[model samples]
Target: MTSCFNEMYLQGAVRPPYARLEGWTRAMPAELRQMKQAEAEALFRRIGITFAVYGEGGDPDRLIPFDMFPRVFSHAEWTRLERGIKQRAQALNAFLVDVYGRGEIVRAGRIPARLVYQNAAYEKSVVGFVPPKGVYSHIVGVDLVRTGPDEFFVLEDNCRTPSGVSYMLENREIMMRMFPDLFRENRILPIDSYSERLRRTLASVAPAKCDREPTVVILTPGHFNSAYYEHSFLADLMGVELVEGQDLFVEGEYVYMRTTEGPRRVDVIYRRLDDAYLDPLCFRPDSMLGVAGLMDVYRSGGVSICSAPGAGVADDKAVYTYVPEMIRFYLGEEPILNNVPTWQCGRDDECRYVLEHLAELVVKEVHGSGGYGMLVGPKSSAAEVEMFRARIKANPGNYIAQPTLALSTTPTFVADGIAPRHVDLRPYCLVGESIDLVPGGLTRVALTDGSLVVNSSQGGGVKDTWVLAE
Candidate 1:
């Protein structure tokens, strides 16, 4: 494998963005570092900031490992990233509105009709209805990976309810508490307004029927869900009610939350549940996690759903290959950020190439997330490679392949001392009245030696990301 780019050091010298951190890491003794690490863990545990990993034994509510070292970005670097992210978000929303309404991009042959109309995530029920502000995906989480100083590629786009913003906020909070001097020394941008920004974004899309201050509620599956803590945490931060299906009901023309002081009208719903489990009467009759007839109210402009139902189709892995085309067709502009070159297994030629090079490429399921159902070919054994090969051959349309990228590395604190670890970033972009994102994002680091995956569910840890102010 080729040597990856080191974000902190270049040509044996500390990079400008990370220069200040060099002395800070060098000054801390091993004993003091260990003590601070323990304190951070204790604080996370005491605050109930834990996540559940499905199908895992022993302690389902596991605390995700938190690394003390932070990932830093220069102001100029962040500016470029921010522009690209916002552009992508706008194009995605435009595509969603067009596909559900007129299918302009599809008609123009910029993207395949089958990829859009026949997608499993495409909701036929939402066919001609446009959400308020024409924004189907209110929040967009674009996963990015860096390979060189000026080379960055989008790994994937999360148009549905994206988890990990809680981690972003918590990581910063803990870092500020543990190293107050770092904040005093550096002009790092503040991300404390993220919750308020999110709240305002949700409220901005209130349906036309709402005349008063729109009531926004976060609709969660339940406490047993893996991201339950995040659901509750966001609710607390935004000062909104976090409710389940049982706590809400659809009345004559609107949905209402059952409160102690009678049922309160809800105008905007920031749902954390999947589309199928959002409305039993519309998608799945057996789904008890959603309110019945809620889709009716949503479609009738009585209420609004952030990331409207059908938004997932825009982020489908197979359809992802056409996002750049969507940008050109919808926004008439070139994509600011490039997508990692992807080969769809659904195509016969691509399938043959992937089969022949199973040991040299990464294969992933079209709908998989949390780093599951993926094969990192460079790090896998022969048996694992053959297994994935067989699976891809059996069902080609269920997968896509990409070359194993030499993901960039950042300074990380390990048991021995400071070292470099592969890392990725997921910045949350909000799209409502306007598209915007905070300066920093959640930086997931691969904790295992020579590993590339950085998902919390896959034993990877997180670090606070910093963007220095100009």
Candidate 2:
């Protein structure tokens, strides 16, 4: 009915990649489906895989719905995505290294100076320092949306310690557990190597002072943070210790993790905490979530941060529009992927256009995440649009606007039957000595019949993403 591409269907014919699923979806019984859904929920509950949603009434910790249907991508399609992801990661890191150390891109006038140096996410503490291996965002989660058969646009880039890989891995694990026969029948590429790849990427970015095999640890903001489960999950998968700020201390010039075997010198940290709470001495003096002088040790090259501090500057939504330019400027190549045509509300003309078309645009805060501080104009009421217009007028620089994308849909199971729901893909590209990722990624689905939001915080669900073998 909609113009958006139905990934599973085209002109009443099943797409080649999804041909085998035609019978699978048809043959699966509703009674068995209901039972399996309950079983999956129990499996997730038993595994303790849940996320915390802030500013919500009642129980904040909730399980993200998991769709039994797997999202499939062909090997060729995945290959294109993999290349684009790596290219984008390399360009963004190069931009970070340049922005922190030099003003080359700014001098070239490729991107506005205020967008970087004046941005809240930019850290003055890391202005002249570069992380080991010149990697700013060690893990890049590039969010992609499809509108047509061959048209995939990158919605945005997650440069600073992107989460949800745990979901990607867990989705596959649960799928195998729930439907082993399906996996056996399909020649899906394996994503089990992600944790091992992550471990290697962390170790590969060890500081110059680390002479021995790097002792990598995941630094979490205790058990109360939203992504605490992912922090512990990745740590467990990587066979590393998960420590809080209290467990890590800076001594002399190096960071040491408190262990049962006494203080173990930490060479690398896969930090899940934010930059503001990373070091109380350097950023927020009143913060209790960070080490006293960890930044000092980090700047002194004692240990490496997986995503170096100040990496969020590159992740800013205002700076996102210049990513293709960053690719051309830094990588000396055109962007392999396309960015959705975005309107920076900071610009007078763009702001005017966005204000005039508030009813049809999707406006989001430049620094907002987790599906908060966003307006989906088409789905919003007139009152909501008016409220958003006033908010944008008051602080135009805080927002960016883009046309509502006709996000592609896939066959998803529901209480009634199989239906089409909007979905998005977040491919995690690990950057360190080299850029690599498992073929599949976290395929987030807006489970509601006509919704477009795919963030779990907005009532979205996860599905196993299967990148079929060649």
Candidate 3:
């Protein structure tokens, strides 16, 4: 039997980082644990911290399952991970800048020109104009999974609007409220400053034309869109207004928010909508989600978009294979964090290999997210695999495949008892005048016994992550 690496234990002994949790888990009775879990759920409901799962039939706003057991890491472990994350974020922004400006990477043959020019995420609207501070991706979320005690790999990059940061904050708050003693016993780093730091990062990237204090706002697609809770929650935390498309208007080169007082000039927009929906005049004509003339204002330096539309080029699944080369070309340093070896199905030989070994690999669409449009070869039945094989054959350019990794497991609080479950981390990296991230991030676990997917939409739950203070 192939045993998955357990994060909390080694040779049946508790690891140093998880030593403090040993007694807490033992002293708590099952009844008390159940009661606390119920209390956590009630608190979530009262606070209105719920996510919308569209097409789920019943009540759409459902609470994401929260686990009491925290995933712990030592100070040294986090320091290393932090450095790698920062390096990756810097490289991503550099690549975005180069692709939109010089096209040097393409000329040098480091990345294919078609990969950028033909990519759905690439935009030619703001080609000549650069963002303030030249930072294209203001906030970067890097998905990571571990396979051993000292091994971690970057699963994917989220350069656009990455969600679930609200969960990170709420999880810590709930944990502290429920078990203040556990926090007191352990020396863990504080993540309370993330909102303030995020605000500062945004303000630092205000457009050059701004003379007064920059006004920041969170642009949402409204309550109907998923991740609405996060949009409203972040706005409240950052002391900014949460506005829909109808709430804002653009005239003569500047964007403004309609207010009871008057038209308020807005300088920075942390938009949560997609690129095509950003400007009906520029993209999807029927979209009521984005401001008209917003892209033109952004190009003219009248307003600064948080991610600067079209930053998604860095995170495209096909573009991911060239990140290591990007690090070398842009940063002049080898990658500290490794990407899981990927096989693009667009290639004839690779596609042939994938079809032959369909049962041992995981295949995913280039544009897939939230665990949808994917196949877990080992878990799928014959008919499902055959269906996927046909789908791949029809459009080979739309898919990528990777080996089935034995993701490390963490002890989770389950119905029967504590059991090991696969988990992954998504640490949000903020880029602007400076690059930073809160010490801990959202730790998602596969709620099912042996499953590997950790997306909330796929029945996964979240756990608070702890980076022990030195």
- TM-score per candidate, chains pooled: 0.99, 0.99, 0.99
Give the clashing pairs for model 3: none
Q: State candidate 2's TM-score.
A: 0.99
Give a tens-digit lDDT track for model 1, residues 249-283: 99999999999999999999999999999998898
Top lDDT model: 1
- Deviation of model 2 at 142, angstroms: 0.6
Cα deviation in Å at residue 205, candidate 3?
A: 0.6
lDDT by candidate, in order shown: 0.93, 0.92, 0.93
Model 1 weakest 10-residue run by lDDT: 51-60
Q: lDDT per residue, candidate 3, 1-470, as tens digits?
A: 13888999989899999999999999999999999999999999999998766556566788889999999999999999999999999999999999999989999998889889999989888786789999989999999999988889999999999999999999999999999999999998989889999999999999988999999999999988889989999999999999999999998979999999999999999999998899999989999899999988888899999888889988999999999999999999989899999999999999999999888899999998888899999989999999999999999999999999999999999998799999999999999899989999999999998999999888799999999999
List candidate 3 stretches off by more than 4 Å.
none
Least well predicted 10-residue stretch by lDDT in candidate 3: 51-60
Q: 1-470 in candidate 2: lDDT tens per residue? A: 38889999999998888988888877889998999999999999999999776777567679989999999999998899899999999999999999998879999999999898899988888889989989999999999999988899999999987889999999999999888988888999999999999999999999999999999999998898889999999989999999999999989999998989999999999999889999988988988888889998999999898788899998889999999999999989989899999999999999999999988999999999988999999999999999999999999999999999999999899889999999999999999999888899999999988999999888899999999999
